[model samples]
Target: MADLIKRIQQGERITITNRDAPVADLVPSASGTEQQTLDAIAAIKNARAGTITHAEFVAMHAKGRR
Candidate 1:
């Protein structure tokens, strides 16, 4: 588990097993704020929708910075 935490610190994924059965995954640590989690979930939902064109996404991101 210590090694898994080290790997997560280095932005690597880890898997956890209980009694030799795969039960969980350890991913890189997030800031763990509610807004951050919500934003990640929203991004995932948008990605799974798969309706946006590449150009549209680029434009939207660019506009966000302005």
Candidate 2:
């Protein structure tokens, strides 16, 4: 646990495994940075099913304000 904390403080990504199978990952919490948003968009694009365009994303944001 101490080692995990140490590595995390150093901005390292850590994967936790059990019996050689990954159970979870320990990543730094996002702070609303632009890179984080881009990474999120990439993840959404890689989703195994549907997609929404940039226009759709903007429309959804606008809709929530009404």
Candidate 3:
């Protein structure tokens, strides 16, 4: 069990089997928030360098739906 845990922490995917049938899987947790923050920051940088300012981007987006 300890070895299995160590494998998981080392970023190895593990399949737990019961009587030779797969029962469960262990994998790394995806970093959604970190990835999203990175993506948003990249987009903002690109917009500033490309065709839009931050204020123009906000103005182009919907303020509210009717």
Candidate 4:
């Protein structure tokens, strides 16, 4: 909807509706400068490249709890 786009551009939070039912959100992506978005994306991409065994991941953070 045009109103939704306008609200998003103006940095206003809005709820999207369909068939009179709220479905999704139309909000600003982040509250930071461009560098933050780039850094976050790079971090996510780098993280996605690795595959860790379940035991390794759990041991790394388990703190001997399990």
Candidate 5:
């Protein structure tokens, strides 16, 4: 597991498998200079700007059930 994590930290993506079938991925987390982290945060906020609230999601789901 440590070896896999080291490889990931070195920019390698590792795919976990089950019975020879891919099940999950072991990828490195967001890591870099402070600027990169800030950029990522800004991108996430921008992407979520148009998202609905939890209450709005629930109301939409209820409407769809009707």
Candidate 6:
């Protein structure tokens, strides 16, 4: 369960399955205060050297998992 939460925190969506069929999805919560959202955006902007498209972000994440 801890590992699953960690994966969700790392931006991976998890599907909960039952009988080999998808029953539910365990995804990160989108709910946050406005200040929190702004803080997160600011933090991200500060962390990166330049902008990246969503595809590039996904690719980078995949590469890091390897």
Tens-digit lDDT track of model 3 for 1-66: 898877775567888899999999987556744675686687678777886776867754543221
Q: How high a TM-score does candidate 6 get?
A: 0.52
lDDT of 5 by residue, 1-66 (tens): 788877886667788899999999877676543555686566557547956677765665574463
- lDDT string, candidate 2, 1-66, tens digits: 898887775568899899999999997666634565686666567543457667766765674464
> Would you list the rank order by TM-score, best first?
6, 5, 2, 3, 1, 4
Of 3 and 6, which scores higher on lDDT? Answer: 6
The residue-level lDDT of candidate 1 at 33 comes to 41
Candidate 4 regions exceeding 4 Å error are 1-3, 31-66
- C-alpha TM-scores of all predictions: 0.36, 0.41, 0.40, 0.35, 0.45, 0.52
For each candidate, what is the lDDT?
0.70, 0.70, 0.69, 0.64, 0.68, 0.73
6-42 per-residue lDDT for model 1 (tens digits):
7776567777899999999988756644565686577
- Best candidate, lDDT-wise? 6
lDDT of 4 by residue, 1-66 (tens): 897777676567898689999998877667543665676565556546655555655654463352
Best prediction by TM-score: 6
The Cα RMSD in angstroms, rounded to one decimal, for candidate 6 relative to the true structure is 7.8
Model 2 CA RMSD to the hidden true structure, in angstroms = 13.3
| Candidate 5 minimal-lDDT segment of 10 residues | 57-66
| Residue pairs with backbone overlap in model 1 | none
The residue pairs that clash in candidate 3, if any, are none
Candidate 1 residue spans exceeding 4 A from truth:
32-66
Candidate 3 vs. true structure, TM-score: 0.40
Query: Residue 49 error for model 3, in Å?
Result: 18
